[model samples]
Target: MKIAVLDPDRTQADLITQVLTQAGHVVQTFGSGKDLLGQLRKDACDMLVMDWHVHDVAPVDILRRAKEKLPEGTPMMFITNSSGEDDIVAGKDAGADDYLIKPLRRGELLVRTQAMLRRAYPSQNGAEQLTFGQYTFETRPGRLLMSGVPIEVTHKEFYLALLFFRNIGRPLSRAYIHESVWIRETVVPSRTMDTHVSRVRNKLQLRPENGFRLVPVYSYGYRLEKLGG
Candidate 1:
């Protein structure tokens, strides 16, 4: 998953990124609310980690505004020095999914982040199988069964298909998809994403007729959307 960390303090933001990245997530850091909001306008991240009080901005305001820009159901957490009950309540009321006091234990941070993400996006949390309308994904073995008829797919194709299904209606950046499927490939091949996505779309019949469509993002990656029934 891709996570966005918003903290004006470079040290704290870096620390959060390191903790989450070590756990297999791709992290992007933002030094100010403006930067984070600008990025969110173009791409969607799986989760957000923020500091309740930034420089001089009012508490809960950034969270409230950021929440309005994020795709629905995206999880967000606050990591700050304060632990006041009222502060926590305010954070939650403003759309924060969870709160963590400063001097965070790495283990606890990881656990809370994981739990929040799992709850927010339950389809990909170690489940062996996931079904979307007529398409069924047996993730353990990377198999796809369309209306009970099996379909053959390569490993990358299976992963690509699964990623799209799990993130239905959300636009995923190209780098995020590449990281999720090609975990070790640092330099993305020029045509690799296009090729694999094309194959997945064709093989799975991901068109409006099939109740889904896999389309390219304007300048980012791709989005899998479920069509009207």
Candidate 2:
């Protein structure tokens, strides 16, 4: 999982980063709420952890804005020194999935974080295989098979295909797709996305016969639709 942590205290943020990293999660720490918000605009993460006293912007304000910008069901948590009932209520009202008091215990933090992740992504906890139509994706081995036969695909192609399959029948915007897949700060050119889409379409044989159609949504992005559904 990719996680973002925002805390003005470098020591505390580093501690959280170390703990999460040791748990096999990719983490990025920010010392300012503004910087974290800036990054969130161009990238997406599996979870966000924010200190209630972050610099530049109020944590509640940050949480509100984050909830508006991030995809639905993206888990968020608050780590703060405030343990007052009012503060906890405010954090929850502002859309935090969990609240942790400052001077966090490593064991408690890990347990709560994992619990929130599981609640938000129940399907991801134990599933290593994803099936769509005749294609089966083995996530552990990073392989794709069609009707039990392996299909040769580049790394990028496989990820692109997986993304499309996961969001089947949903129109994914170009910006969202780029942020989720490439995960870069720089803007990717439209032609780059187009070329990859073309490759994935041809490579996967996504056509009427395959019972899937990958269609371009005019000026928006792409959609993978199951034929005769």
Which candidate leads in TM-score?
2
For residues 82-159, write the lDDT of model 1, one tens digit per residue.
Answer: 557787888899988889987655546776897898899888878456788988988556789999999999988897
Q: Which pairs of residues collide in model 1?
A: none
Scored by lDDT, model 2 comes in at 0.83
* Candidate 2 regions with alpha-carbon error over 4 angstroms: 127-229
Worst 10 residues of 2 by lDDT: 177-186
What TM-score do all the candidates reach, one by one?
Answer: 0.54, 0.55
How high is the CA lDDT of each candidate model?
Answer: 0.82, 0.83
Best model per lDDT: 2
